[model samples]
Target: MASADDVQRLFLQALVSRRVVTKSLARILLKKCVEAVKAAKEDLDIRIPDNDDSVNTFVINLNASLDKLDLEIVPFVDGLTGNQVYVLANRKGDEVAQVASDYSPAELAYFKVLAEMIITAPNSSYCLSSMAALRETQSLKATFTKTHGERVLDTFVARGWLYKSKSGRYSLTTRSTVELQTYITNTFPNDILHCTVCHEMVFRGIRCYTRNCEGVLHNHCYAAYKRARQTCPVCDTPWNGDSEGKLKKVGEGAFVEGQDKHARARRRVDDEDEDEDETPKQEEAPSRLRHRRRGRGKLRPKGR
Candidate 1:
């Protein structure tokens, strides 16, 4: 048993905390609505409104009521099928427009490539290797370079805009995910292309962010592509291509027999630097240590 007041309170809680009903978040709210009713002893006017769609309608109605107060429920995007989510944001703020104006042209273009990579990444990985970014940089050859790209990437890594894996792959961080979701969805409305794997009409899918390859695969097909071949089937350009190529060479349309399983599975050694240090120290005498020992001899005379 739940009251109108209790249902209203739950709506307020949702808007306060999450602000948006992402697919996964929608389930959580639906569960909460149902559970709250069962826990309440007094019945006023509500029980967990049947299902997610119903719950969503309830939320929308609540937002609609706030129209008297200048607040509204807005969908993040239009024309994409399936469950539509409504997010709460103030009309006065206009955050997305303000943020877009803040970026320089180069940085703005970077996000476009990033958004494309995110949609096309296997498992919605939202990650791209540095080598891929370099290709984007090269396209801006008049304004950017490989050195400049690495600096920009490292800066992003430091600023929490991106996560830098030890092997040098860069992925959008949670902060970037939060800030750019609406922007990416709204901006790339027309970059539609086909999935190389299934050869289906894809609104959005995985794009192998290679310099020349730029192969696109359906979201589902990306995993199959990896399992079948680490390299892009069409271009044979590798993911993290600069580092590994035993399986296929760049610009070749053929598969090399053996692929590096670890890189393909992304089971990279996070402690590569530590392991390298230990190996070299164990295998070779420490010249630095010998230098320190020799330099310490002058210090003994002061004690004497």
Candidate 2:
């Protein structure tokens, strides 16, 4: 019987042989295998295990050998939903069989069980269900929130893994999809509406209305135009007539009859008081004017 050390040595030798496997390579291989398993599960609407038991055992043992390695192995016979295992096994029988043929009996058995478990019980407790759903870039943020309950969507935006459209939908960039897989897997957020000119969050803006035209200029950019030139710099559409630019006022009709009546009454009382005060002043002014005229007439006559 092979000792644990012997098994570990042989496994390492196989991995580092002509290929000279590095940690990165191992991660890539694991990712590919996981992806393949996920794909098979999705194609058949079930989980299928990797068919090489030897490989599975080696991976398990290899993970044990390295303190830093935290590999998760979904046991073929355990933790799967009944439907997942059944569907996976039924669809991937040939592939599993072929993989079993290439490996040792122990490895073959391990992989065969993995394949069966994946097919028969994909969502079972024993297996890690692959992310089978293909998420759109726009919906990633919301989905990410729903799935992980974390606010990692901002990180994606910060890293440019996601971009906002003028219409407020989030879409993934090509580089974003490639570099932010881990973040995406956690959760993606809805796309934000960013001003194309300023790259700032664009709420309802004048320049971002047309779906075909994603031109999102900042309010400052729009203000740069003269009154006659108040049109979209991108499309030359009039900003005044743009539906997005129309500001919707909230709670506009807050002042009703009672408030208006009170205000009108107070103004009326003030006007009446002012009129009363003015009448007395006007009467006094006439009398004073008559007296001043008489005095001036007397002085002038005497001088003449």
Candidate 3:
């Protein structure tokens, strides 16, 4: 019969192989690992329950085992989609630059700038348009052309470091949040905003409409908040749930009225090009849209 330690070792190896995985995927992997371990020896007598609780037990034990090595399995809900994700994260150090070990120095420099721009984007849009991203390449000291920059950005998307919207705007993926959380919070302390309801870091969410009110909530959190009270948690101002395009600068610690520039530009471009397939037929109307935007189109991050 395979011991519990055998199963834990197999699960840890799987997590190390895939640094980030959806909770559902992780659960499936856990089952597979148990099966593989059981097959390693004659395990017909000892039957381990193949249920969700098994994962919880495995995670707790594995984390304790990994504590000395400064590695842990971190679980977080995706701010945009609310899906649970598990990350094999390093618990020590703030060397986010070393996360993408495959990239060269020049590529790493480009990635840092691109990520910073997306993190500190104005109006809390937390997005970088394709044009704006490409333009940033010219300002980099490492000498990247628009073509090279575009390719690098594509690679980032492919490697799961960034999410590229159909509209051509780019934002950090949950993987980036998991791996770079420390660097992001430390470097952009003033830019980071936590949910007023859940208190988790919010990349995109609703903000209180009242000027000088610093309340912010994730979309899911806002839905729950609105059901009980139609007011901002921080300032007690009325909220009508139509607070879109009202995010203010993070430094001001307030809410201001304005639409996202990228969204506006995307609208303008769509209007100008009627034949464009910016919004595919498969997409829902903006009113019914969820996490991802139905808007139109950024920069080059290197060698993700």
User: Which candidate number would show the highest lDDT if scored against the true structure?
Assistant: 3
lDDT of each: 0.48, 0.32, 0.68
lDDT of 1 by residue, 1-304 (tens): 4556565667567754655466456656756765675578444445555566776676677777777654555554211222345556444324444353444556545554444454444433434566665666754424876787677666566654566666555654433433444443344333334457655334324555556564776545664567767777677676544633333211112212222222233212322332344324544557533322221110000000
TM-score of 2: 0.18
The sequence of per-residue lDDT tens digits that candidate 3 reaches over residues 1-304 is 5675777788788777777777788888877776777687764443454666766776887899899887789888776677777878765553452553676666766777667667766677677777777776776667788899888888788877878777677788777777677777766667688988888778867777687778988877876777888767898876754653453433212212232345445534433554454454565665433212212111222232
Query: What lDDT tens digits, residue by residue, belong to model 2 across residues 142-161?
Result: 22322331233333334333
Q: What are the models' TM-scores?
A: 0.35, 0.18, 0.73
How many clashing residue pairs appear in each of the predictions shown?
3, 35, 6
Best by TM-score: 3
Clashes of 2: 35
Ranked by TM-score, top first: 3, 1, 2
**Number of the candidate with higher lDDT, 1 or 3:** 3
